[model samples]
Target: MATFDSFFSKRTLIGLALGQFVSLVITSTAFSSSELSRRGISVPTSQSFLNYVLLAIVYGGFLVYKRKRSLQIKWYFYLMLAVADVEANFLVVKAYQYTSLTSVMLLDCWSIPSVILLTWLFLNTKYRFRKFVGVAVCVAGLVLVVFSDVHSRDRGKGLPHFKYGSGGSDPVKGDVLVLSGAMLYAVSNVSEEFIVKKGGRVELMAMLGLFGAVVGSCQMYPEILANI
Candidate 1:
């Protein structure tokens, strides 16, 4: 008796949890791998571009299979989402250059509160007292993590010796970047929620992937040319 909407309702929490786990793994692995690599590692924009490319391919295939008609939403809307997503990914990835993996991960939780506030303001979504309490707890946790950054000295042998991005190995700068990225991610997520609710498109994810790939690739082109 579970309908399509029911599947999303049932799995939303689970999906969120799994997504967090996967993101942590990806970030941590990227940090560790880049430090150990002999050659220069991929930059944040390149990594984001490549990820979206694969995503777009998969999603494009899905659209082909489903035989969906024209894209329901405006191209600019997807451009907005793609820009937010690409910016978030670039910022978060760049943050690793300036701070510990632990610090970046902890600070990235800012998206939860950011999303809540943005949804309230733009989406007109309401929350209960408990939700606010949860945000308070998240704030407390962020404070603890930020304070902990001052005591962190474990860079380990695998980490790179030189600075990677403009962040320049400053924990505060890194934390700020992570927090900013989280806010952008919140924006993208809230927009996606609104689009899904209003447009009622089951293939929203695929469309996002397609648009993200295009925008991300375009953004990466300049960096690639400069580096080359």
Candidate 2:
């Protein structure tokens, strides 16, 4: 029998938390977008902006209560992080305006390879041959999916509920947006990995929430004013 501390170690807890966080984020994003679509409300950018605000509020409050300390990163580095993070969310959410969820799901895995390459180049991390093979496999799978989508699209059965008018609903444009968003997300994740690993930063989640809140709110200001 294992001891309680051994079973519930910090690493184990962190892993569990990370799994839960990823699942929650994915589920929430899918649910929110699907529900909004059902209601004919196309405001993914606005929703994405608000998500950051809520995260900032919740994490910032927690940080203040737990540590009561301010974060101190260089302005330029922080600016890069904020821009990458904000653009990642904004672009992905906005992609939904022009593309189907299926295409988004297939393309968003772009971050896996991007992060692997980034870590290898910037962080001097080395991986086994098997890992490289795994990446190649993933790429091959993605290529197949793309080809299939293209075939179906040519057959006039690509994506359902697709609408094109003055409103945004171009599948090609949406695919491009999703790919761009995925690449941006890769940049943000790579930057975060560098900051946390190389820069020896702690309380990363809190910092992200706070910065996201600030950046997201700033972007959303015009929309807020227009709505008001």
Can you write out model 1's per-residue Cα lDDT over 50-147, one digit (the tens) per residue? 66777667866777788656767777887888889989988888787677666777788999999999999998888999999999999999988776
| Candidate 2 residue-wise lDDT, 1-228, digit = tens | 789998799998999999999988996786677566546665555676666666667766766787754555564676668778887777777666665676777778877888898888887889999999999998887776556555555555444564432123466666676777788888888888777764344455556666776777778777566555
Candidate closest to the true structure, highest TM-score: 2
Model 2: weakest 10-residue lDDT segment is: 159-168
lDDT of each: 0.75, 0.70
Clash numbers, per candidate = 0, 0
Could you say which candidate leads in lDDT?
A: 1
Off by over 4 Å in 2: 1-21, 61-72, 157-168, 198-203, 222-228
